[model samples]
Target: MFKQLIPIALIAVCTPALAAEPMVVQVKRLSLDTALKIAQGSIAACREKGIQIGVTVVDRDGTVQVTLRDTIAAPITVPISEQKARTAVNFNAATSAMKDRANSPIGRIDGLVMSAGGVPILVGGSALAGGVGVSGAPAGETDEECALAGVAKVQEDLDLAM
Candidate 1:
């Protein structure tokens, strides 16, 4: 009798909850068009300095949205750029600044490269929308500059879309 009562009680409690309205959530995401523009702008910025490079853009979830490689850029640059973008998104800051965070145990986790050349794409209230990473520049600062150019190029577009 006690076993039967337990089942009945569970059902009674769950049935009413099932009848309640489900909640909805809205999640912000990055578009591929914007990602492409970021890549192009970053590459162009580096080209101005006579440096051929690779650029990568990733969505908020750290998924690759677009990747661009200059004609003379090394193949290794592709992964480096992507990794940098992912790192930035994961850290919610520029990848170049990740070294400071890496002083903690959690920041030292494997698969995260606390290197330069990565910048987070933030939206309203500093929410992360995606990230952009530039690789193959002569210096990390230059790489970050290119990434900043990429964001600037699409700032208006992103604001309008958002």
Candidate 2:
């Protein structure tokens, strides 16, 4: 009886410690409307430069939200754009800045592209909201410019939300 009571006492003593607080987290997510605006803005920017391109927007989880290809863009640009966007969101940085890692082992990971066209979308210039990628431009820098233009289109709204 004493042995059973000791075990029970220990259980009672440890139970409170085992009690965990309920975990409920809030996270910001990109809306479809915003994703469309980003994709359209990127395409418009490329159009102004006489470049037909493919644009992709991905949420923070690296899930694609929108993909837009200009009428004359090459079909290959679609997958490349999506990969770039996924890479940006996964790494939480612009693909252009990761040039050194392009040939590294990490870059070899599936579904990730280390190209310069991917740009992370941030809320209030801090919280990462998503990523945008542009492909089919003459140069990667040009693609990145278009991606940045798209993010700029919603910069004010993002800032205000913070």
Candidate 3:
């Protein structure tokens, strides 16, 4: 009885030590400055083509971080641009490619648009920082180009900062 009681005591003492603790993770996210820069870059790209457009930047959680609309852009562009950004971040893929999958199981869900002009911003080794979307271009391809330009404008900054 004494030996059995000693083993039980030891087991009880060790059980708490073996218990798992919740993992703590630190994530690097997009900053307001970076989001603004990307949005502004998108706007500038469209301006360079003499087109009025709206741009939106969304965080990894598909929350809008920054939204900029050109003075001449149509009001409809605002929501369209925001949706595009949300779509990109939701899938971690370019919205341009998702266009072909609009009817597929993975597309056209969660109130996101699978059209072109949305691109994801990844950092810290595949970590999704956010996304940028541009709208109001005459063509989806043009919109995508402008979005890409916006990403390029701040690519170096993102890479270095993270």
Q: How high is the CA lDDT of each candidate model?
A: 0.87, 0.94, 0.88
Per-model RMSD to reference: 3.6, 2.8, 3.8
Residue-level lDDT of model 3, residues 1-162, one tens digit each, is: 898899899999998876765468677788898888888888888999999999999999989999999998999899999999999988899998888898887774767889898999987547799988889999988988999898888888778877
Native-referenced Cα lDDT, model 2 = 0.94
Best by TM-score: 2
lDDT of 2 by residue, 5-89 (tens): 9989998999887676446758899999999999999999999999999999999998999999999899999999999999999
After TM-score superposition, what is the CA distance of residue 22 in candidate 3 from its true location, in Å?
6.1
By summed lDDT, the worst window of 10 consecutive residues in model 2 runs over 16-25
- Compared with the true structure, the alpha-carbon lDDT of candidate 3 equals 0.88
Model 1 gets an lDDT of 0.87
Per-residue error for 127 in candidate 3, Å, reads 2.0
Candidate 3 displacement at residue 160 in angstroms? 1.2
lDDT of 1 at 152: 89
Q: lDDT-based ranking, best first?
A: 2, 3, 1
TM-score of 2: 0.87
**In angstroms, how far off is 36's CA in candidate 2?**
0.4
